[model samples]
Target: MSPTKTSVAELSGNGQLVYGCDYNPEQWDPAVWQEDVRLMKEAGVNLVAVNIFGWAELEPSPGTYSFERLDQVLDLLHANGIGANLGTGTSSTPAWLTTLHPEILPESAAGVRAWPGGRQAWCPSSPRYREYALRLVDEVARRYGTHPGVRLWHVSNELGCHNALCYCDVSAAAFRTWLTARYGTLDALNSAWGTAFWSQRYSAWEQILPPRITVSTNNPTQLLDFHRFSSDELLGYYQAEADVLGKHSSIPVTTNFMVAAHIRNQDYWAWAPHMDIIANDHYLDHRLEDPTVELAFAADATRGLAQGQPWLLMEHSTSAVNWQPRNIAKAPGQMLRNSLTHLARGADGLCFFQWRASVQGSEKFHSAMLPHAGTDSRVWREVKELGHILEKLAGVAGTTVKAEAALVFSWEAWWAYDQESHPSSDVRYMDQVHSLYKALWENGITVDIVAPGSDLSGYKLALVPGLYLVREQESAALADFVGSGGHAVVTYFSGIVDENDTVLTGGYPGAFRDLLGVRSEEFLPMPPGQLLPLDTGATAALWAEALRLEGAEAKASFIEGHLTGTPAVTRNRYGAGNAWYIGTVLDPQALRDVVAGAAAEAGVAVQVTAAGLEVIARSDAEHTYTFLINHSDDEHKYPAPGYELIAGEEVSTAVVIPAGTVRVVRSFSSAPPTTGRISGLKDDESD
Candidate 1:
C-alpha cells in the first residue's frame, strides 16, 4: 500500500504516534519480559519489533517448530496495549540448516564460504535456503496473521545489509537466468556489455560469469550489470516472502532500508515502491567528516525514498554505537536533538535498535533505549521523556512535509561513479552530493532528495550533482524539466554515460550535452592538492573539464592553470528557464554562492537561515507544524505564531528554543496539503 492509502495514522494501529524499539525476548528470561512490558508502557512505547533474528528459536529442527515462547511474548505485548512489528525470522540462517546444507553458504569473490556463526550467511539465490525460510514465514503468518497484537508485518530485517554480493555457483546460475530475461540473447548481451573489446565477445549463454576476481580490471559494463542483477535478485527474494505474508494477512509489510551514508550495496530507489511504510536504519558513522550533518541528509534521503511519506526510524543508537574505530558517546542532549531531527523531517515513528542493552554478543556495546546502566542512567530518562513528547504530538501524525526544491540523486550513478576507473580518486559521488545538499540545508531551503527522471513540474529548482548514469527516460525527463520552465543546476561528471555503461560518443557528458548547451572533449582531472584559480575569486581542484560552449555563455573562467581562459562555469538560456553548468570543482563558498543565486532566481524562499537553527515544517490544509531545532550551545529565538505542542501554550511573535533542544509548534497558518505524497511532490513521478 502507498502512503496515500496507508497514512501514518493507519500505521500507528492504535490511534497514537508510534514509539518503538527492537525487542529481543529470547535473549532474556521470562521474568524480565514482564518488567520490560511495564517499562515499555511507562515510556509510551506502542510498538515493538520482535523475532528479527529468531530463526533458530522458532524452528529448532527441520519440521518441528516451537511457538510457546513467541506466543507468550505476543500475549504479553497485547495485554499491555502494545502492537507487534512481527518479523518473519528469516534475517539469518540457523546453524542446523547450514550444517545440513553447506552448499547454501555464500561465497566471496575469492571463493571463500561464509561461516554460519555470522548473520545472513546463506547465498541469496539458493533455492533450498529460500524453501526453508518460506516455510517459517508461512507458519508464522498463519498463527499471527489475524492477531490483534500485530500492527505491521516486517519482512526480513535490513534485506541485503550484510551479504548483498555473493559469488557462489548458485548466484552465478541465477545471474545467468536474470541476464537471459534482460537481454534475450547472447548477441544482445555482448553488444550491451561492449564485450567486443579485448576479444571478450560471448557466443553462448554458458560462457558468461559474474565479474569476480578478474585478472586485471573487470569489464565496466559487466560490473555494472552484475550490481543491477544483485539488487534485483535481493528484491525478488523480498517479494517472495512478502507474497506469502500477503496470502495469509491483511497487515502491511515492510523491511528496514539501509539508507545511511556508509551503506551503498542496495539501491533503495528500486526498493521503495515495494515497502508498505518505508522504514530506515541509520547509525551515526563517526568516520564521516560531519556525522550530524550526514544524519540529517540520511533522513531527507529516506523521505525521498518514501516520496515524503511518514517513515519509521527502525534503528538508531541512544548514544555511541558498537561499530566504528573511535566510538564516542553522545553529549548531554545530543540524543534528543538527533531524534527530533528525524521527526522534523518526516518520521512518524521513533524507535531504537534495541529495548535492552545486550550483555554479551558482537553488538554488546551498542546503545539501546534501556541501556546496561539500567533505569538510573540518563539514556533511560530521556527515552521516557521522548515517549511522553510523542504522545503530546499525536496530531502531527499523517501530516506531510513541504519542499519547493529537490536534489536529484541516483544509486545507479553512485555504483558507476565508484567504479575503479574515474577522473580522480578523490572525486567521489557523495562529496559533490553533500556539498550541494549542505548549501541548501544551511540556507534553510528545504529540499526533497529525488531520483532522476522524476516529475520536476512541482519543483521550482532541481539540483543535479554527480549523477553519472543517465538512461533514455532520465535524460529526457531532465531536458523536459528545463524546457518546461523549471530551473536546473547541474554539476560536472553527470550525464557522462547511458544505462548500458556506454559513453555517449558525440562529446563528453553525452547524455545531456544539448540540454547543458555545452560540449566537452576530455576531462582534465587535476592532482590531489592542485588548485586552479578562477576569475570569480574561487579556486578549483580535483576535476576540471576541457569544454567548448555552443550556446551557453561562460559564467566564470579559469584565470590561471593549464586551461587558462577556459570556462569554469557556464549559464545557458535553454527555454523559458535557465540551466547552470559547473565544469570544475568549486570551493564551499563558491558552490554556496552559485546555489544561492540559482535559488534566488527560481523564487525559492526560506523561513530562517540563522546559524545552528534548523527549521522544517509539516502541514495540512488548515495548519502547519513547525519543528525548530537548536544545535548550538547558545539559545536562539525564531518567529513562530502558533500553539506550542509540547508545552501546550500559544506564541505570538517568536519561540525561544533552548540550547541543544527542540521545539515543535502547531502554527495557525494555513497551507495546502500534498498531491502525490506528504513529500509534497507529484504522483506521476518515479525513479
Candidate 2:
C-alpha cells in the first residue's frame, strides 16, 4: 500500500489542532494514568502518542504478550476527550527476545554487538527482528484498528536514532544484495566506485564488505555508498512496518523523524513519500550561540521534505532537553515562540516528547507538558497558553508559506561534500547553507528548502550552496531552469562530483561550468584567521577558487591572494536569465550583499531586515498572514500596519512585537499562493 498525501488533522479522528505529547503510561504506575489524562484535559491536549518505547511491557516474555496496562490507559484517554496516536512498541527489542535471539542485535562499526539495554539495538537486516517487529505491529493494529480513541498509527519512535548503521555479517550480505540490484554486475559496480585507483577491485559480490574503519582511510566512494546503503536500510525498516500497519488498520501511519543537521543517518527526502504525513522530532542545538536560527532552518527544511503538504511537529522541548551538556531552561515566553515558529513554517500539528515528567528513567531530566515541579510551574502556564493559541488559530491549518526564492538543500550533497577527502577540511555544508539562508532570513525573504529534483518554476531565484554532488538529471534541470529566465546563485564547490562521487574531470566544477561560465584549475585555501579581500569590501575566507571567466563577467575579484587578480564572483547572462557563481566562501556581509543583489534582480523584496525579528508569510486565496516574531531580548517595531491576529486589533502604527513574542497580521493579498510543489515542478506552469 502506498502512503497518501493527506493532511493529518483531516485524517485525525478530530479536526482540531493536534495538541499532544508522548504519553508513557507504562513509566508511571497504572494508578497515575487517570491523573495524567486529567492534566491533559486542563492543558487542552487532544492527542497523545502512546507506547513508543513499550516493547518490553507489550511482550514481557518471548511470544508472550500483555496489553492489560495499555488497555486501561487507552480507555482512560477515551473517557476524556483525548485520542491516541498509537505507537507499535517496536522501537526497542525486549530483553527476553534478545536473550533468546541475540543475533537480532546490531553490530557497531568495530564489529561489537550493541547490548540489549539501549533502545534501537536491533539490526535492520535481521530476519528474526523483522519477524518479531511485524508481529507486534500486527497485534497493535488489530486491537486498535476500530478504536475511537486511536487517531493515527505511529510506526516507531524516532527511526534510525541509534542503530542507523550496522557492520554485521547480516548487513554485509544485505549490502552485497543491494549492490547487485543497483549495479547489476561486478564490472558495473567496480567502474562506478572507481576501484582501479587503489587496486581495490572486487572480483565477486562476497568480496565487498561495509567500509568499516580500515588501517588508513577507507575508500571515499565506498564510504559514500555505505552511507547511502545505511540510510536506505533504515528507511526499508520504516516501509516494512508501515506496510504491515496499513494492511491491518485504516489509520494514517507515520514515524517521527529527527530532521536536523546533526542527525544524518536517514535521507528524509526518500522517507517522506512513505509517510501519510511528514512528522519530525527537532531539538534545538543548545550549543549554538543562538538556537532560534537553527530551529527555523529545521522547520523550513522539514516543510520542504513534506513537498508543500502540511506536516506534524512530532516533538520539541518544553524547556531544556536531557541530552545536551548544558540543559538551559527556556525563558518565560520562549516556549510559545518556539512552537509558533514551527506553525508558521507549515506544521499543522504541534506536540512534544513526553506528556509528564519521568521520575525515574534515562529521560527523567527532560522537561514535559507538566514538568517535575508539577502544575504550578511557568512551563505549564506557557503550555496552557500555547494550547489556547493553537485552538484560536485553527484557520491557519491548511495555509502555505509563499516565497519567490528557494535555497537548494540536498541530503546526498550533504553526505558527499563533508567526506574526508574534500579539498578543504574546514568546509562544512550546513554552515555555508546557513550563511546564505540566515542572510535571506534576516532580510525576511522566505525561502523553501529544495532538493535537486525539486521544481524551480515558482521560485524566481534559486540559491545552491556547496552542491558537491550533482546527478545527471539535476544538472539538466538547473540548466533548463536558467535557460528559461530563472535566476540562480551557484556557490563554491558546487557541481564538482556526480551521483557516484566521481569528479567531473574537465574543470573544477564539472557540469555547472557552462551554466556558471567559469573555469577553475586549483583551490586557494586561506589559513586560519586569514581573509582574502574582495572588491565588495567584505572579505572572503576559508576557500578561494582560481576562477577564469568564460562567457561570464567578473562581479567581484580577489584583491589579495596568490590569484589576487582572478574573479571571486562572476555573473553570466544565460538565455533569458542570469546565474551568479561565487567562487569562494565570502564573509556573512559579503554573502548577504551578493544574495540581496540577486534577489533584487529577481524582483524579490526584503520584507524586514531587522536584527532580532523573524518575519515569515503564509497565504490563502484572499489573505496573507505575516508573522513577526521577536527573538531578541529587546522589543522590535512591526514595519507594516495590518490587523494583528493575537492582539485582535488594527495596528496602524507603533506596533511593537514584544521580546520572545509572536504577532501574526492578517492583511489583504493580491496574488495566490505558489502553485505545485518541488516534487511536481516538472509540470509546466502557465505563469
Candidate 3:
C-alpha cells in the first residue's frame, strides 16, 4: 500500500509555531497531569510529544495491555487544548518480550549478543521482533486513531542505536536475502566485493557471511558492503513501524535524525519519501561557541531529505547538557538566540531535548524546561520567556529561506574515508566537511548541505570537499551540473574510490580526473610542523597531491617543498563553467582566497560583510526577515544599512551590538543587496 502523505505542504495548514517538547508522564504520577497542563500552557506550549518510551508500561505481558494512565494523560492534554505528537512507544520493548524471545536480542560488532537492558537492544532482522512491534503499533493506532489531541505520529525514537549491525543467524539469513535481491547471484556479489584478492570466492548465497568479528582484514569493499547492509536493515525496521502507522493514522509521522551521521548514507533520502516531516537533534561540544555552521549544515541536510521542504528542530539543549565535559549554562540570552538561529536557517518548529529534568538517570543533569529545583530557577525563567516570544512570532513559522550557494556533502565519501587504509591517521572526513562549512559561514554565504546525487540545477555554485568516494553515476551528475553552467570547487584526495570502497584502477582521482583536469601520481604526506609556501604568497600544511596537469590550468603552486613550482591549485573550464581543484590543506587565508575567487566567478551573492557576525534571511511572498547575530565575546559593529524588524528603526549609522547579542531586521525590499568584502567597521563606531 502507498504510504500516507504527511508532507509539509499537506500538514502545515497554518504557519504557526508547533510548540512542544518530549514528555514522559509515565515517569511521573497521573495525578500531576492537571499541574503539568497548567505549566505547559503558562509556557505557551501547544504540542507535547508523548509515549516516547512507554512500551513496558503499555504492554507488561505479551497479550495483556493497559491504557488507563495513557488515556488519562491524553484526556488531560485535550481538555487543556494542547495538541499531541503520539508515539508508538516501541523504542524500548518490555522485559517479558526479550525473556520470552531471546532471538530478538541484537548482536554487536564484536559478535557478542547483547542482553536486553538499555533501549534499542532488539535485533531488527528478527521476525519475532517485527511481529510484536508491528502489533503494538497497530494497537496504538487503532485506539488513538480519532483522538482530537493527536496532531502527529512518531515512530521508534532514534532508531539505530545498536549501530545497525547484526551477526546473529537471523541477520545472516536476511543479509543473504538482501544480497540476492541486490546482485541476483553469487558471482555478481563476488565480483562486486573483489573477493578474489583474499581467496574468498562465494559459491552460493548460503556461503556469504556478514562482516562480524570473524572478518579482521582491512578490506574496503567488505566494510563498505557491511555498512550498506546495516543502513538497509535499519531502514527496514523504520519502514515496518511506518507501514503499520500509515495504515491506521492520517496524522504525519517522523523520527529524529542526527546531523551528518556517517552510519546512514543518502538512505535518508529514500526514507524521506516515507516520512511526512523530517526532524533531527542538534548537540555540539561545549568548546565550540558558534555551532551555526553545524546547525545550518543540519538544517540544509534535513531539508534536502525532504526535497528543500522545511524540517523540525526536534531536539536541542535548552541550557547545559550533562553529557559534555563541562555542563555550562547558556549565558542568559544564548538559548533564545540559538533557537532563532534554527528558525533563521529553515526550521519550522523548535523543541528541546526534554520537558522536565530527570530526577534520576544518566540524563538527570541535562537541561530542561522545568529544572529539578522546580519553576523558580533561571533555566525555567529563560524557557518561559522564549516560549512567550515563540507565541508572538508564530507568524514567522513556515517561511521559506532562499540560499545562493550550496555545499556537496556525501555520506558515501564519509564511509570511504573511514574504510581507507591510508598512510596518515589524522585525516578525518567530518572535520574536512566542517572546515568548508565554517569557511562559507564566515564569509556570510548561505550554504545548503547536499547529498551526492541531489540536483544541483538551482544552485549557482557547489563546493565538494574531500570527495574521496564519487560513484560512477554521481560523477556523471557532477559533470552534468558543471557542464550546464554551474561552478564547482573540489579538493584533493577526492574521487579516489567508488561506492563499494573499491579503488579505481586508473591514476588518482579515478573517474573525476578529466573533470578536475589533473592527474596525481602520489600523495605526499608532509611531516608535522612543515609548511608548503604557495605562489599566492600563502602557506599550506599537512599533505599535498603531486599532480600532472591534463586539461586544467594552474592557479597556485608550491614554492619551497620538494614538489616546488608544482600546481597547488588548478582550474578546468567545462562547457560554460569551471571546476577548481585544491591540492593541499592551506591556511585560512589561502582557503579564503581560493574559495573567494570561485565565488566571484560563480557570481554568488554574499549576505553580509561584517566579521564575527551572522546574517540569515527568511521570507514569504510579502515580507522578508533578517537575523544579525554577534557570536563573539566582545562588541561588534554591523555595517550593512537596513531597518531593524524588532525596533522598527532605520539605521543611518553603524550599530554596535554587545557580545552574544542579536538584532532582527525586516525589510520590504525584494532582496537585500550585499557586498563581499569584509568591512573594517569598528564596534565603538556607534559611540
Best by lDDT: 1
For all candidates in order, the CA lDDT equals 0.85, 0.82, 0.76
- Which pairs of residues collide in candidate 3? 6-276
Error of 1 at 37 (Å): 0.5
* Candidate 1 deviant stretches above 4 angstroms: 1-5, 606-608, 671-687
The Cα RMSD in angstroms, rounded to one decimal, for candidate 3 relative to the true structure is: 2.8
TM-score of every prediction relative to native: 0.96, 0.95, 0.93
| Model 1 Cα RMSD, 1 decimal | 4.9
**Candidate 1 lDDT, tens digit per residue, 1-687?**
134235555556666678899999999999999999999998888889999999999999998999899999999999988889999999999889999999999898888888889889888899999999999999999999999999888999888888889988889999999999999989899999998899999988888888889778889998888888999999999999999999999898989998877778888888888888888998888898878888888999989988888888888988988889998898888888899888878988888989999998998998898999999999999998899888888888877788889999988899899898777888889988888888787666888999888888999999999988999899888889888888889999999888988888889778888888999999999888888999999989988888889899998899875698889888888788888988888988888788878887887863334567777888866778888777888776766667888777787756777788888878655444221111211223221
Candidate 3 residue spans exceeding 4 A from truth:
1-14, 260-266, 287-292, 325-328, 637-656, 672-687
* Residue-level error in angstroms, candidate 1, position 510: 1.6
Tell me which of candidates 1 and 3 scores higher on lDDT: 1
**lDDT score of residue 541 within candidate 1:** 90
* Per-residue lDDT over 1-687 for candidate 2, one digit per residue giving the tens place of the 0 to 100 score: 232377767633467567889988888887888788888888889889998988889888767889988888898888897888889989988888889899999998788888888788899888889998999888888877888888888888887888888899999999998899889999999999999987999998999999877777778778888888988988888889888888877877888988776888788878888888889999888887557888888998888888765789989989989998998888888888899899888888899987898999789999999898988889999999988887777767777877788888888888888888667889889887877787777666778888886779888999999888999899888888888999999989999999899989988778899998999998877676888787778788888877898999998998874677899988999988899998888887788788878888887775443566777767788777777777778766654456787877786743567777988777777754322111111112211
Query: How much is 642 displaced in model 1, in angstroms?
Result: 1.3
